[model samples]
Target chain A: MLSLDHARTILDVVLKTGTEKGFKPLAAVVLDARGAMKAFAAQDGTSLKRGEIARGKADGALAMGLGSRAIAKMAAERPAFVAAATHAVGGSLVPVPGGVLILQGGEVVGAVGVSGDLSDNDEICAVAGIEAAGLKADTGA
Target chain B: MLSLDHARTILDVVLKTGTEKGFKPLAAVVLDARGAMKAFAAQDGTSLKRGEIARGKADGALAMGLGSRAIAKMAAERPAFVAAATHAVGGSLVPVPGGVLILQGGEVVGAVGVSGDLSDNDEICAVAGIEAAGLKADTGA
Candidate 1:
C-alpha cells in the first residue's frame, strides 16, 4: 500500500524540484494503487486546469498499467484505441510523459504525475521525486 | 448566472459557518448556473478527495435540477434509477446532503456544496452561505 505519508513526500519533492529548476508553476498528484487520490496540489501560479491534467496523467498510467511515456507511444501508434481508452477511464487519461509508476520490490504500489513544464521535464521531476521517496520509478522508458 | 463575486461570497460564508460551528475542516465549491466552477476552497486539514466530492455535490445538483438532499432521497427510494443517473452524469453525482441550489426571485442562479463533516452539518453551512449572499437556498427538502 502506498501510504499518505509516502504520497506527501513524493508531492513535496516534486514541487521542490520544480521550483528549484524554475519550471512553470507545476501541479503534482499522487494516486495510490487503487487509483484513489492520495495527495495533490498546484503551485499558486499554475494555470487553472493543470491539477486535473496532473491527475489525468497519473490515472492514465494506472489504467493501462504502464508509464505515461508508453501510453503516449501507444497513442501515437493507435489513436483510435487510445481515444476509446480515455473515455473508458472517465476521460482521466492523458497520454503524456510525467506519469511514472511507483515500484517496490518490482511490484507496483502507486503513481506520481507532474504537469506544467515540457512533458520531458515533467517526467524528470516525477522520476526524481519517486527516487527521493526511496522507490523505483518505472517511466516505461 | 452568478458572478465570481457571488460565488466567492458564498464560498466564504460556507467556510465561516463551518468553522464557527466547529465542524470538520470543509471543502466548498460554487458553480454558476451553467455548471461551470466559479470558486472553490478547501480548508488545510481536509482529507484527500473532499474537494472532488464537494464539486460533485454541486455539479450533481445542477445536472439533476434538484438539490443533493433530494437526490439522496431519490437514491434511497430508487437505487436503480439513481445508479443510471449517476452514469448519465459521468459519475459526478454524489447522492448526499450539502448541495443546495441558489435561487434568486425563484430562479436557480447557481449552487453551493460543502463537505467535511456530517452530511447534515454540511448542508447547514451550504444553506447559510447561500442566504448570506442574499440568495435563497433550496435544499430540495
Candidate 2:
C-alpha cells in the first residue's frame, strides 16, 4: 500500500533538492492505487497552473501503468491515444514530464509527479521523491 | 498574499472533515493571487474526471471575484456569463458550490474548490477549508 507518509517524504526530499539546486518549482503530487492523493505539496513560488500539469502527468502514469516518459513515446506512436485521452479526460492527459510510476517489489503501487521546473529537473525531483519514500526507481525498460 | 501552506491546510482540514462525515469527495484546489494554484489535492476513491470539476470551480471563483455559489446564481440569471466563461478559459470555469473565495483581512487572496461530493457537501468542505486556512468563509454576497 502506498502510504501518505511515504508520499510526504518524497515531496519533502524533492523540494529540498530543488531548493538546494536553485530551481523555482511549483507543485508535486503522489497518488496511490485508488488514484487518490497520498501526498501533495506546492512550493512557495510555484504557480497554480503547475498543479494541473503535475496531476495530468501523475494520472497518465497511473492510468497507463507506466512512467509518463513511456506514455509520451506511446503518444508519439499513437496520436489517437493522446487525442482520445484529451477528449475522455477533458484535456488532462498532457504529455509532459514530472510523472513516474512507483514500484514496490516489482509491482506497481503508485505514482509521483512534480512541476514548476524544467522537464529534466522535474524528472529528477520525482526520482528523488521515490528514493526518499524508500523505493527504488525503475529507470530502465 | 495567499500561501501554499494555507492552501495545504485548507485541503487537509476539508478532506479530513469529509472522511469523518462520510462524504464522498474527489478533488480540491486552492488558488492564490493572479489566480494560480497554491495547492491541490484529489482524495482516494475519487474519479480522475473529478479533477476538471475541481479546477473549474476555483477558476470560476477567481474570474468572477465571488464564490462559485454566487456564480451559480448568476449563471442561472445571466446565461451569457456562463457562455462567456466557457469561451474564456476552455470551459474551465464551472459555476458551482464546490468553490470558496479566501478572504484575509477583508481582501480576497484566493479561492478553494472541491468536488466529488454533493454540491452542498462540496460547499461545506470549501467553507471548512477556508476557515482552516485562517481565512473567512464568504458563502454569500
Candidate 3:
C-alpha cells in the first residue's frame, strides 16, 4: 500500500524542491496505484488549470502503465494513438514529462506529478521529490 | 480569500462530520474560485473514483455559477443542455447536491464537495464543514 504518509511526504518535498530550485509555482498530485488521489496541493499562485494538467500527467502515466515521459515520446510518435488513449481514459491523459511512477521493489505503488515550469524542469523536481521520499522514480528512461 | 487554511479546515471537518454522523468513508475536495483544487482528501477505504466525483461536484458548481443543488434541478429539467454543458466544461461537471458554493459576504470565493453516503447526506456534511470554517454554504435553494 502506498500510505498517505508517503503521499504527504511526496507532496511536501515536491513543493519544497521546486521552491529551492527557483522553479515557478507548482501544483503537485500523488496518486495511489489504484489512481485515487492520496494527496494534492497547489502553490498559492498556480494557474487555475495547472492542477488539472498535473493530474493529467499522473493519470496518463497510470492509464498507460508507463511514465509520462514515455507517454510523451509515444505522443510525439503516434499522435493519433495517444489521442485515442486520452479519450479512452476519460480525458485525464496529458502526454508530457513531470509524471513519474513510484516504484517499491520493482512494483509501482503510486505516482507523482508536478506542473508549473518547463516540462523538463518539472520532471526534475518530481524525480527529486520522489527520491527524497525514499522511493524510486521511474521516468521511463 | 479562501486560503489554504480554510480549505484544510473544510476538508478536515467534512471528514470528521461524516464520521461523527456515521456516514460511510468520505472523499472531499475544496476548490478555489478559479477551479483550482486548494485541498483534497479521501478516507483510506474510499472507492478509487470518489475523488473524481468529489471534484466533479465542486467543478460543476463553478462551471454554472450555481450550487450543485441548483444544477441538479437544471439537469433534471434540461437533460440535453446539462449534457452539453458537462462536455463543454471538459467533462468535469457532476450535477448533484453534494456540491455547494462557499460564500463570504454574498460573494462566491470557492466550493466544498463531499461524497460517500447518500447525495443529500454528502451535501449536509459539506455544508457543515463550510459553516464550521466560518464561511457560508450556498446550496442554491
Candidate 4:
C-alpha cells in the first residue's frame, strides 16, 4: 500500500511538470492502494468538465490496473470491454490520456491520473509524476 | 483563488470530526475559488453510492453559490429556477447535504459538499469542515 506521502509526492511533481511544460492541466487525482482518492488538485483555468474527465480516467486506470493510454489501445482492439465497462459503471469509466497507473515492484500499487491538457500531454504529466517520484511507471505492455 | 491547501485542510478537519464522532461518511469534496474540485476524499467504509450524491451537492453549491440545503429549500419555494438549473446541468444539479458554499470575508470563494451518513450528518460535515478551517459557513438567508 503506497502511503499518502507517495501520492502527494507524485502530484507535486506532476504539477511542476505541467508548469514547466506549459500544460494547463485541470485536475490530478491520486488514489491509494484501495483505489480511493488520497489527494486531488485542480489548476486554475481548468474547466469543470476537465475535472470530471480526469476523475473518470483515473478511476478507469485504477480499476483496470493499466495506464489509460493502454486501455485506449485495448479498447480500440476490443470495443466490447469498453462498452461493458461503460455500462457497468453507469458512464463513469473512461479510457483516456489522463489515467496512469503507479507500479511498485512490477505490481500496481496505485494510480495518478490528470486532465485538462491534451491527451498526450496528460499522459506525459502522469508519467513524469511517477518518474519524478522514483516510483515505477506502468507504461503498459 | 482558494488553494488546494485550504481545500485539503477542510477535508482533513471533516474526516477527523467524522472519525471522532463516529460518522460513517461516504465522501467529501472541496471546490476552489473557481468552483472546481480542489480536493476529494472518501472514507474507507463509505459506500460508493454516496460518492455521486456528495459530488452532486458540491456541484450544486458551486454552480448556485448557495448551500445544497438552501438549494433544496429554494427548489421547493421556486421550482422554476431549480428546474431550469437542473436541466441546464443535465441532471447534475442535485440539492442535498454534502455541499456548502465556502465563504471568506463574507464573499463566496468556494464550496464543500459531502454525501454519506444521514442527510443531517452530511450537512454537518460540510459546515464542520468550513468552521474547522476558520472560515464562515453560509446558513443561507
lDDT of 4 by residue, A16-40 (tens): 8898998875578887666667667
Model 3: per-residue lDDT, tens digit, B11-84? 87898899899999888999998887998877778897998898899999988999999999999999999999
Q: Write the per-residue lDDT of candidate 1 for residues B40-103, one digit (tens) a residue.
A: 6666567768878988899899999999999999999999999998898898888899899999
**Model 2 spans > 4 angstroms off:** A1-6, A20-22, A31-40, A47-98, A117-121
Pairs clashing within candidate 1: none
Per residue, candidate 4 scores C-alpha lDDT tens digits across B1-141 of 666667777888877777787887557888776656788777765653555577788778778887888888888899998989988986767776557888888788888878777777777777888887888877343
lDDT value for model 4: 0.77
lDDT (10s digit) by residue, model 2, range A32-115? 876666666778766547777888888887777778887777778999977797678666665666678888998888888888
Could you report the DockQ of all the candidates, in the order they appear? 0.09, 0.30, 0.57, 0.35
Runs off by more than 4 Å, candidate 4: A1-26, A31-39, A44-48, A59-65, A71-98, A102-110, A116-137, B75-85
Where is model 3 more than 4 Å wrong at Cα? A73-91, B71-93
- Ten consecutive residues with minimal summed lDDT in candidate 3 chain A? A3-12
Write model 2 residue lDDT over B1-141, tens digit each, in one string. Answer: 877678778988988888888998557877786777676667655775686688788888888788888888888999996888778867788887877888999999988888888988988888987887778977544
When sorted by lDDT, best at the front, the candidate numbers are 3, 1, 2, 4
Off by over 4 Å in 1: B1-54, B58-117, B120-141
Stronger candidate by TM-score (2 vs 3): 3
Model 3: per-residue Cα lDDT at residue A56: 94
Candidate 4 CAPRI level: acceptable
